[model samples]
Target: MTTTHDEDAHLASLGYTSDFKRDMSFWGNFSLGFTYLSPVVGVYSLFAFAVATGGPASIWAVVIAALGQLLVALVFGEVVSQYPVSGGIYPWTRRLWGRRWAWMAGWIYMIALLVTIASVSYGAGPFVAMLIGIEPSTAVTVACAVGLIVLVTFLNLGGTNLLAKLAFFGFAAELVGALAVGGWLLLTQRHHGLSAIFDTAGTEGNGSYLPAFLTAALLGVYLYYGFEACGDVAEEVKDPRRQIPRSMRMTIYIGGFASFFITLALLLAVPDFGKVVSGEDADPVTTILQNAFGPVGFRVVLAIVLISFFSCALSLQAAASRLIYSYARDRMMPGWHALSRFSPRRAVPPNALLLAAVVPAVIVLGSIVSENALTKIVSFAALGIYLGFMMVVLAALRARIKGWRPSGPFTLGTWGLPVTLVALTYQVLAAANMSWPRTPDAPWYDNWIVLLSAGIVITIGLVYMLVARPHERHDAPHGDAVASTLDPDSGRATEPARVG
Candidate 1:
């Protein structure tokens, strides 16, 4: 029941003012995160790969990843609950650590988000072409992907209200489609029994399944992240300190269930599990859907899938632009003046939105260079996002060790340090698993693309930090000394704590 004035005062105490319309309700925030975490998109994109890599048992990765990410989400809930800032990881890190740490965290995260936007739109291209009855040629796919990016950019430019409405529509459509499709498959098309999920289907290498399972875990890693988008636009949500944390947790709970349900139904519905496991059925999703629903019905399902992709891309763009604007607003990057300009009429950062669209579109064009470019882009995007999450988690741990407690309405209280420690541990292991070079037959660079991409980005950020010193800018408040004094209940300042 925090009022608008209270929200504004909370933001002010954190050294920022309300520049957004604050039209997003708790449901709207949840919808935004749900669409960003787009179970349909993630399941459709990675289903074949996961099955191929780890067989039916790969589904367990979904559960395991959900459990791990829930820990991270709980840690994030405490952080965002206290900070309640628009930039999410960036501001949270700043308040927990220092300006330099926040700068790097934002830098890495912003790049990852841009790459993810490209990856999602690029993924949508095939679906769009399929829905339109066009050949999914490279040229056609690129055109479709770029067109989707442009379409979402315009939608985002329309304002937060439009964004929230489309996100909610997407959430509704995607959820209903998932349920209807999964239920129908379960009732009339299931080819396997309840125990099929436990079968490995001969995917184990040398009698050990751990490697394959870890590779397949990428599906869950990718799906769980979009929940953070709820907090990226924290300033737009009413009573964000309480509502955003709940929205984030709800996003993971609901989105995770939807993902698990769809994946389970798909596994049970496959007409030939051996065909899928042995690579005879390269596209089991299409094979199963076409067999169950026929061409016309499959096309209807494709249309729904296309909507899910569009909404996922839309949410990614929105989150990326907010991070960019947040960086600019704090003068923590070059071109801050131009990127920070907020349109009062639309209550949107038009320039930041444009940057989000343009970078991803350029990345879409990179597909012309190599057929595998999109896959590599996606790999790096996932890695980058996990790394970004780890940075925030690490900062929070450091702050807790230094005696900084979360002073928020939704704090973990005595459990804070334990949750933060576990979340950080999970993130580190997940990230290392993601970056491990598994493809030995492929070129060295191909196998190392994830780490290489991260290294290059980090190197550039480090060079820029040393040269430009954006964190030292004096126009805006830069660190967490002011934040230590914030009263958890009233969002007012008190005597400062002796921690960063």
Candidate 2:
């Protein structure tokens, strides 16, 4: 087993010291990723929209997404196994390509994570209100959302140990809750046969089912991503080069299975499939659970759902703060010194955590501007995340073409380039599908929100890179670890250089 001394020596070779506590075990890392990819939150939040837009057939999107994301996860495993850096996509891109590309990748990913924090907290609002027996009005929901953000921020500030404990608890509660609810619904409340999954229920817009299915596929796209959070906190985990990869794959497998199970159960148990497809039943999840579980039981489920949401937000905040700290540590952003400051007592970056909280709370307040703001936020968050992911995939492809072979313990070997290419291709198509203007009847900006938001953020990052050139700073290493020095003929690194 790799000891803490080995981990620290590895970091030294990578041109850094282990500033974090490094107390998180493999299970804690897995819990963090699992909570971030909370199936309860994903299915509960998107079920109504997906079912209404594409009928029950939309559940297939989960399977498709899981397979595609598994490819991406494989590629990430190879990267993180070698680099094992704290910022995940940012550092991986930096090592694979260069600093300029990494700056943009981190910039895009940071914004996406902040938006997702808002999205998850906003989603938790209704469940919070439902648990308290109050109407989920816009005002009440936004207030609750902001409150949850603040609460989760405090939880995150409590240090990695507490975060890991809560994350593990949240994972257990969410999984058990999902299984119990799904099984109960299947056994006692199912209204449709398995055939219902194939029925379109008239969601075929203009005699073509393709567009509707693509639109509904956002459900799966949104759920599969949080697995990267495991890599985002790499510096805090023990033996990360090996353990983080395993934890990431485990997160996708377990989280993907849980997502599919809950979605299928909900689809089969819908009291009126036609009503949901017609949008007449806007809250089918709540309706089904309330009818099946009764008021008390439904409230209990709501409490469980709220816990899932909280854990999701906690994990997101943790990931975001780590990325910020990583960027700051590399002097890739403004106020680097302050943001990079780590609390010796708490073993966390306080300033970065606070920034994560503030940005999301401000976004939550945007709910007052438009009732549909949260939907737009959610859409753009998914698109931005995929775009960031593709950046790393593209970088890996570039590196492979330039004679870079993964020196990690978890490499794909001869299959490396193939998996990277497929992952990149899938991400591109998925991102385009997400950003495509599908809502012809809505405002132009509404239809174009995903693409437009991405364009603006990328444009800003490009302009900043050109003018500021933050990537040129020498505050930290900007390429692969010295230990990963490559050899030409074998396409593998020579013996790693030991750092004294």
Candidate 3:
């Protein structure tokens, strides 16, 4: 007995192409380099995490996080090389673990996207306020979020064509900005000591190097947050089986290396941490440049800052909307079919992009009711996303232990164990070092946030098991044979293989 994908047939009825065409050129994928780095990571919010922790120390945290995630990226590259589906981790997790685990991973992953929509909305707010020259009123914030959502949705409505164009521009802007800031700091070296960034105990608010270091590393992780967007765009990538892995691997290299250099430069450029920390405008990125170069330099930096913010927001919209389209294609969510429809004319997921836009718009408005709501949501979403990442990494490790070897286009070779270990270590540190503020201004309570995210995941998982497990069991294939589908590329229903 064969079960057909109902969603696919319905999508076909709308004249949508179910398959992601392999039309992305090498440069096309490369142009999206910034998109991989921009989302919460290489751009503005990166400064948020840095300031939240303790200036340059946060740089160390981001570096550690990057190292750990590089391990995760290795495994991701390996899987994507073989599967190359737009669903990314969801499909990879499903193919590795099978139906039950896949469903849960898919669900959790969707929630992660939803959480990101609002978080990005929050991140966009400060930039919006700065650009427009006004206080961040709730209405203005909401309008900015909504406006961006509209802009991105329109861009995505044209599918990879528009995304490709935007990706190139955004990627170029980010590259220029990162290099300009980093290069200036490196060349000037007025502060003159790279070691000062790491060694400085930081005067204000209880200066301990170890705790500060850990917190700073967490900031670094923010720069690495959305590199997985490479995988999300796997569907539209040319030679996805090979290209996806290459893109994933390159994203880590480009994004991580760029972030490291930026951090190093910013570290050297930081003049007086005490003055900057206590200053009226607390954003460390702005302060670092303003102090080093003065007002005129500061204005130039601010303009770059605005462009960086826009780039990040654009990237977030791209990734989140694609995830929504992927999930909707699976029929697990409402309006799933319609949202999955790729326009035959435009060749993009128009409805899904609009749907995704609405969510962030709602969040931006909600944030108006209270301050830092976007931050809380982003943190909240990050917790969920990181949990999914952890689970996928663990599963990948398990597959490796079981001698799962897939002949994908990309790999980390015999060093898989070390890589996985390094990644896990980074996650542990990032999770453990989060600071719970005594003051109410912090968007999240560090202690409760992680716990709450875990609780929600477990509760949802258990409920799914209790309620949905039976249906899945009843639908299982007979005679101890697990159901399988013929590979779309190969057209053969081979037994499942593990990935080492």
Candidate 4:
């Protein structure tokens, strides 16, 4: 079977061994990215925020963000095609740069991913409370969130195939749900016209729409990600050199458009924009659903949202664990043997899965003390991912300037450098925008929250890299077994033989 022969051959070419089983198909790989992107979970959580910030015109920001991310995805697709390894960003960065660079990338990415789990769980808690018809207090929400994490962690421990199935189902649920609900709302409820998006109706008291639109665009910031999950599962997907890259591109193409239309439909459907933007309507999504479809419809739509949140958590955790296992397996991280060990029977990393669960659970618990914890944590989370992504882009750009070429199935050809430049520039601008002090009225810590939080993480990672000095490139699991170095000037060591 190609699963054993073809996959392992490619792995050996990239210096990775045959470890995880390659049972994932093209659709299965796509499903992970789709579910992780989780349009419903993302759009619902931020729809009101977008409306409040920039009204309909801010919807353009989603499109802009998606296009920007597509550039990043293109770079990623090229890299993953050349080296279809397990860990997405961490391992990819390690190969492109070095052990030191990779560790910082891993540190930034892993912490952000863990915070993402908590953010998704916290966002979904209110929906769970709404479904149960109970007031969602801090304690109630925390309990529901803890239960959600525990349940998903168990499902993740079961095996890869089951996780893939659930991801596909989640994709189906979200797609059908978005089209059905969004389509109906568009056709029936038309309080605003096609030009309404630029009306700037909700950005009251704010001096200019530019600042408000920028703030509103945060809704679109993290939504387009989760495509990298495909790259993370490269080792488990058959013919990953081909499939993984395609899966990543498709993840962005579909997730971006779906997010755009659903947002458009919701924005166009708002009956009273002023009230919702003013925080008078605390739950605008639920309000829109109830008014459009009545009680039964609201519940049905809520079910789809729940499934989306569940799937997003599932895929995010799966990606995070794979990152841990890949880094640790190379002895590049602490507790290498333990975190890297896969379940003999289950075919998953038991320790990594557990770490994924525990860290997020602790973050969720802290939400009980401070109301702004989730907001600040989620805000910083996007910046963290951006930081890691920029590093990867920078490394690739550096390698290319040194005459490195793609050895895998995909390449940007003449457009490689230009696309990478745009991507890198976009990430730096976006990261700065995210980290800037937005509010002059809020407390100093609150205003500088994202920057401070990011500083702490960056400092920790840099300190570890300087002092601890993790395993070098040659110390990777099969590092010594390399047969040739890909490029002489690329600072990379010998490339390993392809096992078949």
Candidate 4 lDDT over 245-331, as tens digits, reads 889889888888889889889988888888877889867777888999888778888888999999999999999999988888877
After superposition, candidate 3 runs with Cα above 4 Å error: 1-17, 39-43, 46-57, 187-189, 202-208, 277-281, 291-300, 372-375, 432-447, 457-500
lDDT of 2 by residue, 1-500 (tens): 68888888887877778678887999999999999989999888889999999999999999999989989989999889888879899988888877988999999999999999998888788788889998888899899999999899998889989988999999999999999999999999988999999988889956899888998998888779888999999989988988998998999899999999999999999988789887789899989999999999999999899989999999999999999999988989988889999999999999999999999998889879986766766667988999999998888888777667677778787898888899898999888887889879998998899888888889999998899898987556665533256765665656533221
Q: What lDDT does each candidate get?
A: 0.88, 0.88, 0.62, 0.83
Question: What TM-score do all the candidates reach, one by one?
Answer: 0.95, 0.96, 0.82, 0.93
Kindly report which residue pairs in candidate 3 clash with one another: 41-222, 41-223, 58-216, 61-216, 61-217, 62-217, 62-220, 404-499, 404-500
* Per-residue lDDT of model 1, residues 209-236, tens digit only: 8888888888777778987899999999
TM-score for candidate 4: 0.93
How high a TM-score does candidate 2 get?
0.96
Q: 306, model 2: CA deviation in Å? A: 0.3
Clash counts for all predictions: 0, 0, 9, 3
lDDT of 2: 0.88
Clashing pairs in 1: none
- Residue 250, candidate 3: alpha-carbon lDDT: 73
Per-residue alpha-carbon lDDT of model 3 for 125-188, expressed as tens digits? 6666765568876677777767766776676666676677777777777768778778887887
